[model samples]
Target: MTVVGFRSSIGTWGCAIGLIGLTLCWPAITPVSPAVALADEPAAAETPPDQPENDGSTETDSQETPSTGRTLEDAPTLERQVLTELESAPHWPARALAAIRLERFDCAPTRDRLIEFVQHDPDWRVRANAIRSLAERSIEQGEGWFEEEAEPRVIRTALRYGYEVDAGRVHRGVRFLLRSNRLDERLLGAEIAAASGKDDLVADATDTVRSVILRMDRAQAGLLSPRLSAMTGVRGLFSRQDWMRWFRENGRRVELAETRRDPPNPHPPPAGERSFLAELNVDAFARFESYVQQWPELRIDLVFALDCTGSMTPVFSRTQSIISDTMLFLQDITESPRFGLVAFRDVDQEFVTRPFRLTQDAEEIMLQTWLQEAVHGGRQSESVLAALHDSYAMSWREHVERLVILIGDGPPHRGEGGACIRLAERARTRGGIRTQVVEPINAPVRDFKEIAEAGGGRLWTLDDYVLILAELLGLERSDDIDQAFMAFIRHYTELLR
Candidate 1:
């Protein structure tokens, strides 16, 4: 088995090709004067370097002036350059730059181009940037675009725009969005309501959010709960009852003091490194009849298709810890586990699918190191179908149980729904490969249930990952086998620290 060591720098650079900054920001729209564009000089002062955020602040006396002194004396020339870049940029990165620059103009042509970008930009980042651009122009114009836009990024950008520019507009738009049956839209509305501190919006949408959470299965809960907590600033509210109690007790008092330019982190920083014994906090008392009965462990060929997107960075770290630290345990199972890993993110982010072939390497040192160096993903929605298809293509040993554990936070790209289920169905019936899903915290479990069911596998939550895997592998908590495993984890954590 040739396990090559390789890495790609897809999302780490900011000079021109990759993401401008690790922090998410609205790229400012600066109009370059014809004099500046034509002359041997730098661009205008309005053109700030592509920083992730812009805090609506002007340069004070202490701030330095632009090296180039070309002023916006002629609107027509600046407008022409913006239009030219929007239409003629050779690459998507260049196109994204133009889209960001397009945010400054208020003319009809500018508005039309933004709309076009929102509708047709193949790159979601560019489209999202366009949405922000359109929103910054005017709330009325943004609301108009919202009527025609359905992408989650566009809707999210519009909501933030309303929160940034006009609260009443946010309330109206959220009200309309919450009325929809679309889960993503409703969730966006709920988050905005919680963030905006609009009592009326909260009163109207809390019930809906609660209902959705209540209807979700365990895997779905694991993924959606953390997001709700972050958006509402409610901690540890994982159950439906918890949400109801919070609303009844403090919903009215929930007044957002100001628009949060940066939303709080979903995965809060840990308090401190726990004692090695803490790693053995397995749910021994909890029963695992469903997982054990439906999908017992066997000699298996496994593929872990993971979401390596930006939002998943926290979970990704945890995942790396679990996989790398438990290599000995994974190898010691009655049916030795041969693992193939696929690290995936959305299109236009970094590399889409970085695959590692099936191996039972005792250390998995290379995989561990590669995980450390993986670039952060750019967008939220990932290429689920692509990852699953790649997983299904891996070579499997004869007479072994074949499994693919697909994990991620958000749903698949638009128009690619049910594609995974279809593939899983075929793989199960014809190829004997069962596809499971380990929905990471805050991941939406929309079609993952269907995918698991189609492959005759149980859908799992990241919260129950350890317990379920232990049970499947016939490893008991606190047993010699388990202790040895925890010891390895302890050593791994200490070394990393």
Candidate 2:
């Protein structure tokens, strides 16, 4: 389909603060000339409430519009302007807005650029918008183009994006995606089931997807809250168990021959609310805190975000040693303390991020196994943003103080004005995941400091970070672990000095 006319306007878009940027892009089509419209000109069409932009605030205010007074007026110009912004825009909001606006532009290059964004953009918002935009455009343009031009990966990405855009057209896609054993794909299916707002459809989800829904963290719980909340008149439900029970009891309602005609609820619960999930979480956490204060011990959910890049090779063995010892210490001192790990390297590497589920492995063997087996080889910068995003997603037990200790030697890609900092803020404000950065004596410290502060965590040298964690957990430093930590502190201090 060739577009004869279109208009671009800087409009307000929803920027999700903490969760991987998930924004809805709906471009308003207005007939206009092939000339670029200046910012001062009034927009012909009203902007959709879900326009994607990066403002770093967790609040989803519909009234928030882009500061760019300009709008797109033609396909050729839109393609040029959007592509230019995606390539060179200094700020994420510009890139994201470019991506959201790209949806309405119809051209072969636009399609290709959207696919590129899906594959390569470091920022998740750009990639998501590109996927959603491509899916919407393909649906509108007809099957001929997709049948002839779309690749398998593109089709799969489109199917997932279709769930967010138009679920009605992607039933077969959802079913196909559900059959995949990959956790990410299954997650796509589960999200589709929840987004569909049809309980029978959700109930029919494969066991894998069902299990995922049953295992969702509070953030994931928030995703399924809209229809569930509206259905039960219960606004504050959290945890996979509560949702599973509700689904099992109400699954039959969605199976009726008559389709439910409930108006879509605009406000799906936000994950960052002070009363996240249930009132029970608040009460339980309050009691847990009181109990902890009385007991004089720390109950923490600790995750290690280790940098496993080529530059970090020198410390790989030592890092593993540190993790093994720390886990053992936690097991002995804290009451069933949970431990998790995220090992990361830069983009275009063997892997960007490798995440392990939270566990209390008393043996402390498997944690060591992963630490030893994972190789780090790539560019100097790494996927710190990806690691932070995964850290936010971990299912920390309720009432446990969530802490992520990021141990890395390289700066995060897109460190300046990137989504990583905002995401860190999101993790702190929404998920209550405090982060601490442990920079290698040789690694860049400025980025680590900024990101750690943004996430409400601290930045320290490797040795100091280890000691701080130990002290907080009330672990005695009189042991071999403490000696090893102290030795490193002296070595780094002397070496750096």
Candidate 3:
């Protein structure tokens, strides 16, 4: 809860590169002090093969001793003093050793000293360095203090020190600027400003000021990342305000309108729709999950082929649970597949979810939060097939098994749906992908059945749609999953054998 930091020895820009700034406060009794930097691209570095990569994986060497140990436990001296500097450690490119070292030693006094420097230090770079220190230390609890902002520590540090490169901070500040109508006020103390009086952004984003302003306007106009907003139901694509408030006032109203608008289907399914649930047990799904779990020599991946044509409006309404639910299913699975979602319509396409290598649990909560606040979509060609092809072609990571999950009303617009099935078949034949189709019954299944068969994937009707989704993504099957999974697994086993 303590928001603290100190400048590092490196200069301001150095803080941006190696990102070594804050030395957050901890309980250790003693203290020391520091100062600012920038430098060449972080020097290519190496650590013991067991050590972490430059990208911070070193924080996870699995060698990290959990802090559950009692406070009295002995602490290891930081192997070396000069090398202890993370932002400027010259020899090793400052591996996780530096960050890990900070974790063990009580840096509270150092953190306090950093805070003091930021508040009083004349050099904006020095203040920037102070925040860098805090950013490095924010993960003390593993669960980030990152509220909706994701990095209050770093943003405050960036604001204090005058660097603005992080996409998050840039967007956050833009949102604030829009809401406050006080761009100049927020720009006060804006150290990173250029002669144009606009804040100097990160090198990667040097040209986005005008663009960002436009984005802000679009967000205000409710037109940013319709795909993301639709999937997450998170209004204000980039609208900046106390979102929780926006969520309460506007979110509640939208939700109420939605509920009222979509009266319950007069034809709810009978309670006894599915009685003998043979697929509920793992015996039925051993090969499916086990194969997926052990698929990769090292990793596996998942992709969601979401639909977003105008016809899908009602589907989105009833299917707000799709994204959140699928994400949770990924969490329940033993194999943590890198996940991404691709929502497509011909004229307009939204990657809304990009493919990334990460465990399902890591993404599930955020995906759920995203879905709860996301918006519905726009109109376009029912291009499920084209979206899959392009997404696969564009993906760079080599995954073990590419699971393309198609979430749409069964089939596509007339003469347009076969591309998806063909793409799935191609992925399976050459790339070892395991394709599955979670099609809805809202549209005709006439074309969907052929599509599913062609792709060698399973097809399910949207009865207890959410439950079907659960099993397809390996979630806990409620009812439909039990029925549908059995059929799918059996077919897969028969075909593979």
Candidate 4:
């Protein structure tokens, strides 16, 4: 079999380069490139409504016909070719790419085809891409479509896109995700519900909501409490029992105040009203102090599986610093912290993977030595799957918070048919190891997202390591940390604009 490498501008992230029939290389973040000519099809008499308006200048045109030696007259022909590919492309990747390309077209036919893909596409990747494109264009497919979608990834895409086409659909989707067994999905549901400020979104699922609250650790509960309080019109409650009791007692009668103005004073101040605020403040302070006292007893085991291939040379030093800083931070919060390392390269490299078993803080020096000794030399695709398998087999502490952070810049060798995702699922189900994937800049995200979802963790960028570490460790509550995280997100949003 002959392998060919070709780059095609798929979506907003950047171009995807196909290598060895499986690998996809995501270039660094940049503006969406002009559409490439896929095929030589007959021109249509009238231009589609979604087609970009053609101007004389090459810079302003959205099509790459001029560079390809084709004329601007072939713009409609190119649209037909892309639409045809979306409908009948034999390979799933081609179909997925076509769906991404259709984002530039917002006509009825483009929307109808994308909606069909969302409803009936055999591949989940294709369906996810289609739904994302629709959401990006802000074209709603009405109700009952996204609400009934069963795949967690597709539902997550809708949630990330804030697909509020219909309130009922969004409510149903949130309910479904809240009930999901995956921790990441449930967390996302809680975040969306709290952010949406829709008090009735989880009205009937009080028990499920309480369970989610009960599962959260101290830091998580602290960060989420104020927002949830604002949404539920309740304050100073921490435990699940307190929340449920309040819901049962005053949930239906209490309505969120419509105005910010102070309520009218009672003719005669109620008894104990003078001390109520003081008492609540004292109770909240006591609860936080108790959590702080228990922090030292928490146990955690973390393994870092890094792709030590030549391509990662540019960002490898930064990766090392992130890992080191995380370890130092963990030591401050927990008395018992175990660390491990797995450095991986390609099959033909000096070594495919060098793994260091989970060791206590006393042996941190050895782990750092192994990490620094890794040499970067290999093909584009490294032995990522092999490294994950090794990391899962490490001597993880039983009953501790087990975590694996996989940092890489490309896909696994030959893709391995999603073997890494399967391994992550097995580790989560049998070993309770939550796997997080950290991509540097423009790494391909589809495979990493799937693996993280399977392992009940979220995919994060390299810049988010501090926040990720803080969340996983349930570190001390600090307003600065929260503000920094939100600011980073806003920065990314501005870049998208």
**Candidate 3 has what TM-score?**
0.35
For model 3, what is the alpha-carbon lDDT of residue 352? 34
- Show the lowest summed lDDT stretch of 10 residues, model 2: 30-39
| Residue-by-residue lDDT tens digits, candidate 3, 1-497 | 11122111222222432332322221121011121111123345556787654442222133232233212123323323322343242222122122222322223433344444334443333333444443333312111111222222233344332233444434434333223222221221121222112333332122322232233321222212222232234543333332334445653332210100111122322322311221123343332333233222334466666665556655553344444434433333324545665655544344433333333443343332233322344443355666566556535356445566666653454666666667667777776666666666454554566666666666765454444443344545435435544443332221111
Who is ahead in TM-score, 2 or 3?
Answer: 2
lDDT of 4 at 365: 27
Q: Output the lDDT of residue 454, model 3.
A: 65
TM-score of each: 0.37, 0.36, 0.35, 0.39
Expressed as tens digits, the lDDT of each residue in 170-214 for candidate 2 is: 354445446544333444444444445556655654354445555
RMSD of each: 22.7, 23.3, 18.9, 23.9
Runs off by more than 4 Å, candidate 3: 1-300, 348-381, 394-401, 410-418, 464-497
Candidate whose TM-score is highest: 4
lDDT of 1 by residue, 1-497 (tens): 21121111122213232211111121111000000000011223354577644332222222232222212233455444544644565444345445544544434555566667765676554666665554444313322233333333444444455523245445554664466444444565665665555567666556656665545532233334445555555665544445556767874344332323343222222222322222222242111211222222457676778777777655654555444434433443224567788877767866778777876553343343233333565554678989988888888888986778787876777667688788889999999987778787844567878888897776777765655455445455556445434433333222111
**Which of the predicted structures, 1 or 2, would earn the higher TM-score when compared with the native?**
1
Q: Is candidate 2 or candidate 4 better by TM-score?
A: 4
| Candidate 2 CA-lDDT value | 0.49
CA lDDT scores, all candidates in order: 0.51, 0.49, 0.37, 0.54
